[model samples]
Target: MSFHKYIFHYRFSGKSDKPLILFLHGFMGNIHEFDEAISLLTDEFYCLNIDLPGHGKTKILDDDCYKMPKIADALINLLNELQIERCFLIGYSMGGRLALYLTLKFPQRFHKIILESASPGLITDRERLERVKRDEQIARKLARSVEKDDFRKFLDNWYNQQIFGNIKNHPHFEQMIENRLQNNPKKLAKSLQLMGTGVQPSLWDKLKENKKPILLLVGENDSKFVEINRKMFAVNQLCKLKIIKKAAHNIHLENTFIFIENIRNFF
Candidate 1:
């Protein structure tokens, strides 16, 4: 669907009568990010999977559309267009942060939410500024990755981060990288510049205002987000935190069964 300069590539599947689940993917992921999970959930859930701005086949006409608030509005409009009054939401990594923003901004549009490896963004200006610089550096690298090999190398290093925690060792890791290579590196740079956590608004103060139920999923191996989500759970009365065993930032890819189990049990 095209909204202004943003063209969102999405797939809506399963029975119309079933409850809907809006699945948002992490950075470098497309609408197929949760395909395996969605395949298993088809009997019980109507899934709406979208290629977030700058990823997959989704095209961003204006860079402004990549901003958190702007993208959130676009998503709400998409739901309205689909005639979905309310639905369950699941977000992973970057998408998780966006899901949280959508939940807080348009709580009535969502029933329940599951945030996997997400945060409320940086707390203070200094932290945000520092993060912005870091993201810019990474963005520059992405922009320079015009060649397929360059992009592949970048992806390799990305998963090597401690937060990703052994994801590269997975049997299908090469396939995952192949999928990521489909994205336009320059466009991804724009997304990282505008939608990165450093640039997004801090949801820390707004967390307590959420009235809907929230499930915070974090992998035990990813201690950084574990602590972040732990603090989130502490602040929000309706939020529940679950630390998945033998996984890290990309929990769904690392432990698909447990990830699906949590979704079923939570929603």
Candidate 2:
């Protein structure tokens, strides 16, 4: 509960004898998101699902805690205090980006990695700057435009995105994201602008240089991320890609059985 003044909310299963599995949720998402999937896998491994800063029960940092590097460092600190020597790190989307960043930053602390629907940060410095500017604007807008239905509007825009654009009417998938989105819009927007992978340093080179085993899973309907995964897998020899059939960006929720089976097999 009190891992350094940072207050990280987490859930774990299994005894100390088994391997540890860390679950990192996506942007604007918290530990609750992985409950269903973690429930399916913890019988074999110790699961640690964390509530990242600015989301769920975790308290926001005093300064801007939106940067990926800062958040990753905080998590690393938590692991150190937990006395966890090594563990398998798994992340989805934003969580995936952080997991890879964490593994690359401290490779020895993690054994294997699972990244679902994640990508390396913005490719060029120009792209990074552009995203940063865009995020800043969103942050400003959130401060000035906070409204009761702002969260709903954010989801509307989120669902309109190309990756998730193809998914609709799928109650489970919709519910999963809705639960994540059912929070203060101001915080969500601020977190996205500040801690977003779009604003973080690009890690494609680090991914290629790292020798750890990595699994990249995404849905077949998510064309944008699928293309990125293909490129990442082709370039990174240690990377293995898995495409879930009939699923969208939120594969774990869209096809829970397949998501659980695939990740369980990987672990």
Best by the TM-score measure = 1
- Alpha-carbon lDDT, every model: 0.93, 0.79
Candidate 2 residue 132 Cα shift, in angstroms, is: 2.6
How much is the lDDT of residue 51 in candidate 1?
A: 94
Give the residue spans of candidate 1 off by over 4 A. none
In terms of TM-score, how similar is model 1 to the real structure?
A: 0.98
In candidate 2, the residue pairs with backbone N, CA or C atoms under 3 Å apart (3 or more residues apart, or in different chains) clash, namely: 66-194, 66-195
lDDT of 2 by residue, 179-228 (tens): 76655566767677767756777898887898898999989989989998
How displaced is residue 34 in candidate 1, in Å? 0.7
Worst 10 residues of 2 by lDDT: 142-151
